[model samples]
Target: MNAHPQPAEDGANAEHATPSGPPPARLLRLPEVINRVGLRRSAIYQRMSEGRFPKSRSLGPKCTVWVEEEIDAWIRGIADRGG
Candidate 1:
């Protein structure tokens, strides 16, 4: 009997493994953004109110998301400003 687990026969495991290059760009939900930026929802709203953070766009009747590129740009701006 094999002691080690075998990979999926169809390469599913390999396909799902994390890539080495840059992450794929895609809109993230508010909670995900909050976790990534280490800020509470209230603080996010505060920054949006002050025009310091990118605003979210409606994705559905009750859904919203932030543009991946915009968030990346904002992060770059902060890094450039030494924040």
Candidate 2:
């Protein structure tokens, strides 16, 4: 068997891999957060202004990203409240 298993037809692992549970930390870009949360750019900014969303951390002059854990927590909160 190959040392590195290939992804299945759907491009996902055929079997369960890691059993450690969710990642301890993750970094995600603005576009990724937007897509995952189904939020518009303007809405994201609006939420930031209202302190309802995770703030981006500066990476450089023109780069920033949100903490994946924060975003995940926010999603979980929303789900818990049935929102």
Model 2 clashing-pair count: 0
Off by over 4 Å in 1: 1-25
- What tens digits encode model 1's per-residue C-alpha lDDT throughout 1-83? 96655666765565466667987779999989888777899998899999999998997999999988888788889889998
- The Cα local distance difference test for each model comes to 0.85, 0.87
Displacement of the residue 29 alpha carbon in candidate 2, Å: 0.6
* Residue runs of model 2 more than 4 Å from their true location after superposition: 1-24
Residue-level lDDT of model 2, residues 1-83, one tens digit each, is: 78877776768775745545765778898899999899999999899999998898998998889999899899999999999
Total clashing pairs for each candidate: 0, 0
Best by TM-score: 2
Give the distance in Å from residue 6's predicted Cα in candidate 1 to where it truly belongs: 34
